[model samples]
Target chain A: MTIKQIERLRKGAITLLMLAISILFLLPFLWMLSASFKIEADVFTYPIQWIPAKWHIIENYKEVWIGKFPFYKYYWNTVKVTVLTTVTSAFVSALAAYGFSKINFAASKYLFIIVLATYMIPHQAILVPQFILYRQIGFFDSHLGLILLSSFSVLGTFMLRQFFMGVHNEYIESAKIDGAGHWRIFWQIAFPLVRPAVATYAILRFIWTWNDYQNPLIFLRTDKLYTIQLAMQKFTTINGEFYSLIMAAAVSAILPLLIVFIIGQKSVIEGIALGGVKG
Target chain B: MQKLETAAEAPKAKHISKRSSLQKKETIAGLLFVGPMLIGVTVLTFIPIIATFLLSLADWNFIAGFKDIKWVGFDNYERLLQDDGFMKSLKNNAYFLLTVPIYLAISMLLAILIDKHVYMKSYFKVAYFMPYISSIVAVAIVWQVLFHPSAGPVNQLLISFGIDNPPKWIADPKYALPSLMMISIWISIGFNLIVYIAGLQSIPKDLYEAADIDGANAWHKFKSITFPQLSSTSFFLLVTGIISTFKIFDLIAILTKGGPISSTSMLVWHLYDTAFVNLKIGYASSMAVILFACVMLITVLQWLGQKKWVNY
Candidate 1:
């Protein structure tokens, strides 16, 4: 064969290999999505029936939504916590980032390093003390406590700081010459310029807070306060023997996050890329 | 305003104005903006960490009053040194660290292969990343079912292939930790792949063209060009991956609860069990401090290692 033909053949082989690899990666999710709609008896059928003999999608979803498991309550709780944490974290981190980036002060560098050092402390190390302290303050088992704890992310602070540093000094100087105070300059100039970064951090913080299980598990004890993950765990116990129902509940719990990710993936990927670069 | 003018008259307004109100105002705004975070770090994080250190030195149980507290300076650390469970956890964590690098390499390979193919990139990317986005609780539960010895799909598949007896995965002390490792590697490959793909895409096409012009084969080009260019991404993945894997707890909690015979208990999982289940808060705090020190030491060593190889 000619060189060009050989090259085409090689490319075809590589594509075929990639296609096989992709199929392997995708198989479990396909099985999960398919099994969610299957009858309980059909869940473990041999050779793995790709399609369910019977579709129980409606029944499964109905049970998941309004059954003994208060799945909807969990969804709402998760939504509230996630939204509050994301907005507050983004706002606070951005404001702080502007301060660190533009404002000159004594011991600023030392203070920034101290903030960065906080990132290195493992969550496990702080759990006992934090739990004890929160209990003493009567904040334990309260949504406000969880929200407050989630809002103070060192990663968000560092990410926003990097973005704020990238902002041009000229804009702040121009705003300064106009007799605009520091807050005015921050709001009018820096905020708009770094809007993309702010949005990126917000979406990421939302996903992280939404997916976090340990904090919610430890802090939120009441059934009413359960988040989606905690709710999913509760679903398992309530319907311990019903594999199909549990799968359905799991699907419902993940669906919102999947939707959010699909919608905001571009910014999320960009933010991760930027974060990796800084690291 | 007249009083301010009179005060300014006593001292030269120029001298007073030498330090720009702009500077003072900016300083105040900076403090105001960072104020909440500073307070949080001091009260919620920094103070708690110091408190943990102190708590580790005392034996205090919540059920018992503070009046009954006992000072156990170095006793917890001594027990930790002699405790078989703690030693087992440390060994398991080391095994976890060893296994993680292999998984990360596999992920990098998968990412590079997918990146080389021009089509179906996003399809593979999303598929690989699905596990990363899924809850660890869900992942662990699903894997637990899959690994069931009697009727689970994995064993059933093995039986269909003519194997007589499949190992009871999470139940058997021998197979439990390895089983956990396998599932972790499977779930984590996707996340690292995403990072690798991002790194691969950033490389200029012209570098490959130059290699091709020099009569370099695919393997040679990959070794000299692709791998070198990807070193920074690789280092980032290695450090973060090790850190994350070492601190793993949720999967162990959901699946094995530190196990059939404590085989699957990682350091963090052990720490959790000690603190929450056993209520050995002081001992658990010491374990946590040890874990923290281990992580810090590893990170520093990795940084030093990177100085020899990592370009930037």
Candidate 2:
């Protein structure tokens, strides 16, 4: 065979391999989408239906959204908590990062280390006491409690601190020369410069809060206050036999994140990558 | 605004005083800036941690409040040594950690393949990474449907291949933990792939060119150049993965509920069940302490061990 023919053969093999792996990775998502639209009996039919023969799209989605349990309530609860948590976390962490990086005060280094040391404390280890404290402080059984618990993250503070540290001290000095207060400096100069980093952490915080189950499970007791994850758990347990309904609910639960991934694809990859390598 | 005029009107030596006051103002501003976090970390994290440790020492049904608490000293810790539930959960965590190596291999392989001047790079990346960003609850539900006993696609396929019987998976005692591990592996490989791709991209091209000039084969190039360069990323993944695997709760909660005779239970699951369901506050706190200890010990050991070979 000619050299060109051999090269073409190698390329063909690689392309085929790539396609196979991509399809394999995408199979679960495909199954979820296809199964959501399939009829109850057709949902699990053999040969793995790539496409549903009998589309039950309206019926399945309608039952999930406004049926007996009203899944959209949980969806709205999640949206409320997610938005509040992400905004609060990003803002709080940014302030803390600015303080830790730029300001020099008594025991600043030790205090920062002490904050980071909390990362070593397992979430469950703190849960027992936090649960008690929540009861005492009137934070139990409400979205407010879940929101408070989710809003403060040590990892987000640490991640954003790295970006803040990259900002030159000369800017702080020049701003001071202009009689700009520290708050002004933080609001105007440092934040905008690291907006991408802040945005990265914010997007991640949004996803984490939206997907968080443990906090909602432990802190929330009211059926009306449940996040989508908590609701999904209850829904699946109660409706295990209804594959069509469960898959439709799964599709609804994942739709937001899928849209998020599509829109912020590059930033999400970069955020996790940066977060990983830094660790 | 008037402060500047007053400073100018005063002695020139007072210039130093103005600057000093500004520094003082900054100190207060710094405290004020970090005040919310300080209060948060203390109330939610720092105090809870200390409180958890103290609570572990006492016997309390958690109904009568702190006033009715009884100190049991080391009794809870003693019970952990004898608890079969605790031991089984620990073993299950070890089994779950088995996913780490499989994840590393599959993610690494895909990274190498896609790294080789592949076309439609972003398209391939999005497809592979879709699962990592997906909510675990949704993933579990779909997998539950797929793994259904009689009518599910997975069992149906196995039957068509002429196997008389397949494991009940997620419901069977022997297959429960392993089944969860499989779902974990499926959900996790996307993250590993993204991290590995980033690691591969950071490796310089000249390393490959230098290998080519020496007539080195792909295997040789990979061993010498690729492996060392990616070692740091792999080490990071290893330590973090170990820490995270110790805290595996969401999947167990959604998929198995630490059930079918507690086959899929991990430390977090056991702790949750103990504290919330059974109301064994003291006992569960002890378990949480152990969980924290294991995570810390593994992290410290990894940090110290990385001194051996993780080249920056």
Candidate 3:
């Protein structure tokens, strides 16, 4: 074979190999998706039926979505908390990033270092005292408390500051020279330049909040206010024997995240790329 | 007198006042912008940390209210050494650290393979990254079903291959931690893979050309060029990955609840149980202090260690 032909053949073989690996990697999810459409009796059938002979998709999903402790309530709660948290975190982080990167304040260096230091202390270390403090302050067992817990992130501020630094000094300087206040320059010139970075942080914050089981698990006590993760756990426990229903609920819980991933795949890849080079 | 002074010092005084006012505006704006985060971090994180430390030295049942708190000094820390459950969890967390290097190696290999030769990179990236972004509750529940002892796909495949008694993964005490580790590896490899691919792409290609000109083989090129060039990314992944393993709670909570004889119990899960389930706030705070200390120690060690091997 010619050298070009040999190289082409090798690449083709690797592609085929990766295709096989992808299938293997995705088997569990594909199984979960397949099982959710199967009847209870067929869920564990021998020889592992990859497809349901008779589809029970509507019935299974309906039971999960509208049953006692309906999932829609939890979904609504999750959406509210995740959306509010993301918006607040992104804006607050961006504002802070702009301040630290662009504004020449005397205490900015020390303040930024302090913020970075806080990221080192894991949230798990403070849960005990936070629980007590929240209880004492009457913020316990509320969605508002849960939202406030993660709305201000040191990591978010730090990540956004890196991008804001890439915005040139000339833009802010010209805006200042135009008799614009710091606020006007921030809103018009600085923030727009780093909007993509802010959006990236917002997207990450959304995913983190949506998938958060720890905060809601601890802070929110009312069954009526449980988020999707909490609700999914409760549903699974109550219906442990019904794998079909559990599979359906599991699929419903992650469907939105999958949709988000699909729509924001470009930004998500960019976020990881940015994170890759961080020291 | 005012008119005479205005005429004499108008330009120089006006410039000084304008510059100071602008500096004042900038400082005010900076404070206003950073105020929310600063206050939130202080009240929410810093105060709580201090409270955790003070509470660790005192015995206080959260239900009993403030006046009942009893200061016991180093007693709680002393008890940690003798507590079997705490010891097991400590050991388990150390064991979980094994997943970091394992995933890092696997991801590095996959990253190299796909970065150079693959078609449809986006499809593969998304497919692999799916598990990383999916809700851990969903991921855990799905894996729970997948690891079912008798009827699950995994054991079914094992049976087909003539293994008489496949291990009961989550249920079996001996296999539970390993099973959790396997799931963790699966969930995390995609993230590591994505990051590694980004690092691989950033490597300068002329180094490879030089190596090829010198008659270097693939392994030699990889060891000298690819590995060293990618060391910083590797170190970043290593530190973040190890830190995350310390935070493994959702999977254990869903799958084992640190059960099967506390075989899969981890530090965070144990702290959660002690604080929330048992309401031993003081004891849990002591554990939290230890947890904080360990993370600080690991991070400091890694920071110092990076100077030797992690290339900037």
Q: Score the docking of each candidate (DockQ).
A: 0.55, 0.64, 0.73
**How far is each candidate from the true structure, as Cα RMSD in Å?**
3.5, 3.9, 2.3
Residue B20 local lDDT, model 2: 84
lDDT of all predictions, in order shown?
A: 0.82, 0.86, 0.89
Number of clashing pairs, model 2? 0
For B20-118, candidate 2 gives per-residue lDDT tens digits of 887787789888988898889999999998988898898888876778888999999999999999999998888888988888888888888777746
List of clashing residue pairs for candidate 2 = none
Candidate 2, residue B186: Cα displacement in angstroms equals 1.1
Report the error of model 1 at residue B82, Å.
1.3
Q: Kindly indicate the candidate among 1 and 3 with the higher lDDT.
A: 3
* Fraction of real interface contacts that model 2 preserves: 0.69
**Candidate 1 per-residue lDDT over residues B179-282, each given as its tens digit:** 98998888888778878888998999999999989999989988998889999989888888888877888888888888898999889888888887788878
Model 1 is docked with a DockQ of 0.55
Q: What is the TM-score of chain A in candidate 2?
A: 0.94
Q: Write the per-residue lDDT of candidate 1 for residues A68-176, one digit (tens) a residue.
A: 7757888889899989988888887887788788888875778888988988887888888898888889888988899988777778888888888998998888878
- In candidate 1, clashing pairs total 0
Please state the CAPRI-style docking class of candidate 3: medium
List the lowest-lDDT window of 10 residues for candidate 1 chain B: B117-126
Report the C-alpha displacement of residue B124, candidate 2, in angstroms.
2.2
Q: Write the per-residue lDDT of candidate 3 for residues B1-312, one digit (tens) a residue.
A: 999988989898999999899888778988998889999999899999998899899887888888998999989999999999999999999999999999999999989988988788888898888887888899999899989998888899899999999999999999999999999999988889989999999999999999989999989999999999999999989988888888889999999999999999999999999888988889999999998998898899898998997875
Proportion of true contacts reproduced by candidate 3: 0.76
Off by over 4 Å in 1: A1-8, A277-279, B1-13, B16-21
* Model 3, position B62: C-alpha lDDT score: 80
